[model samples]
Target: MKKLILPILLTICVIAISCQQKEKQNSIPKMVNSDGSYETVPLEKDTLVLKLIQNSVRNVKKIENAKEVVNENLQKVKNLVVEACTTGDKPNIVLMHEFPLTGYLYGGRKDKVQMALQIPGEETSELCALAKQYDTYIIFGSYAIDPEWPDHILSLTTVIGRDGEILKKIWKPRNIKRFYSSFEITTTTVESVREKFIEKYGIEEELPVLRTEYGNIALSTVQLDPFIFSAFTMKGAEIILRTSTLFFESDIIYTAMANNVYSAMANIPADSPYGGNSMVVAPSGKVMARLDKTTEGVLEAKIPIAKFRENRKLPQYAIELTKDIFKQYQEEIPANHLDMPKEKLPQNGKEMKVLLDSLSTWLNQ
Candidate 1:
């Protein structure tokens, strides 16, 4: 009888421990909603983690030397990624600043072409290897030469997947034609370049969203238009990554809030006076983490997918206003239009002033 009692007591203890473990497993923390209501939000299967690298360019004498510079910079990026992985907070996506391979330059088209890389060429292959090594998606920008036009070079932003695949490559629609024109570079004409871009890459009427494990991400340049952001959001983009030579804080914030999505901006150091302020903005349009304007470093942020979804459902005044404006001009506005005038663009400072005065007159009229 004593032996039976001992066995029964041990069994009861085991059952009690199993129940406590099950209860703990079922319990989850409650989250407060915007309306002050507490509710249990289920944990997401995956979190959207990101790292934006704000790099600085090292001046080199010749374009040929740019390759070495690029390799060194890439090594730095790899080191940072490895460190992040070691810390057990590895980022799922890493964004690089504009002109990561070769810094922005104004020179003869032929000279620039010599420095330009071919898409899926040697440079991008190395980037792919890096992406595979870290098992993270990488988005980087470079000046690339289209195979169709060996003499012409286009600015490109490419997305590399964790499997070392080229997911998407986008040609920058807007380039610094004004500076190129100043040098009498014939290949840099706005109309001619636009035609070449359209011939190779289709007209970018809508932003491209990359569907990934984290979320749908869109890549844009510094020349992003407000309408582009709206178009992306409408297409179900949850995060927009902007790689730029310059930082526009107000525009980034407005885009995040209006679209109710995360916005990450990666800019280079102020070595060329155009780089500064690499940052990540939350769905609420709040700056989450930012690198110093002059510093060259990596900024990482862990964005909650659940929170983004919640904020997206909230009422956004900008979106409401946009809808009202669209309704008012529903019939007047054309489906697609380019506002560029028939007249040639200004070629010099004096001509620019005259053109501005003419534009002002036209607007006032």
Candidate 2:
């Protein structure tokens, strides 16, 4: 799940409670916009947890050659995520890991080339175990090597139901190397992965025209950008919801006549070079969830457009929350003082703490 970026204007005609009552709103969502889009509603408990996990692991590793650092960081995150998943021993689990390796073209150098270059065997196994233990399904993103083709490739592994059972996978084209990959994951016993793939990737056969509340969304065969997951456009609602194995890409965007969500997050290295995760985006973008391999590994939260719409102040409000969290991380562990070289380290644990705390507060906010 990518972070909420930009302010989504909701025109719900409802008064909102002050931030003090945000706790009560946890079960019930506040109205941020006054366009009558949605009534003040409360998110289910599971929905909130999913949002928290999304933001927890923003930037996994930042080191250049710190393979060991990357490996350790990934494990720590996995443990934390696993713990969260089994908190109440929830029966059915849907885990999505959106690793955006080739999304950002910074200075002509892809940010996630490290993870894209090679598939870390250990990391793959770890994720597989998590899926098995929780009976979870994952939308894993990374660079993959073509077993039959003659090239290195970036791919999203559609691994599901544990024990190295591959359900379905999609690959993307980036220069000579294939960059993006996505697909649906089902049980190994699933007789027809292709059928599920058609259902997810090819939703058109089922619904020729889909209607949404906003206006109109257009569902096309076109996979979303970066990684072409599955794209559905509700032309009636003017919203496009895309599902990518990679998080940063706009798998889901509510596009009205005015603004759209660049709802993209960064990719976590299978072997993170730093001690934790780090996610980078334009100041306007937001991170929605963080999924790791551990039991307590996942965290999720969302900036409901309704919460801050009373005075057209929700976007800035979310920005303040993100900035304050970053500031807190700097206070806890000065980035300059980390053990690893400056370039190789992701934001320190202290920064992650700030992100986590901020998410917790946002839920209450």
Q: Which stretch of 10 consecutive residues in model 1 shows the poorest summed lDDT? A: 330-339
For each of the candidates, the C-alpha root-mean-square deviation to the true structure, in angstroms, is: 21.2, 20.8
**Estimated TM-score for each candidate:** 0.68, 0.35
Residue pairs clashing in model 1 are none
Per-residue lDDT of candidate 2, residues 1-365 (tens digit): 22433222222212243443665546432322444242222322212112123322333344363355445545654665476567754423233334322221111112343333344465666666776776544434544444332222234434344343444453331111112232112101111122443334552332222232212222211232322221122111222222232332333322211233223222333333321232211114343443442222343333333222233211212435576675665322121121223243323234423433443433444
Cα lDDT of model 2 overall? 0.33
Position 306, candidate 2: lDDT = 27
What does candidate 1's lDDT look like per residue over 1-365, in tens digits?
A: 98799899999999999999888656522221345222223433457778888877653336777678767766776675566545647878889887776676545444666766778987678778878988888888876777665455556689998999998886554433234332322222223345444545544422456666677677877453676676666656778888887766788888888777888888887844345778889878889998877887678898887655553442343656577777765322122112233235333335534443444434445
lDDT of 1 at 68: 89
Clashes of 1: 0
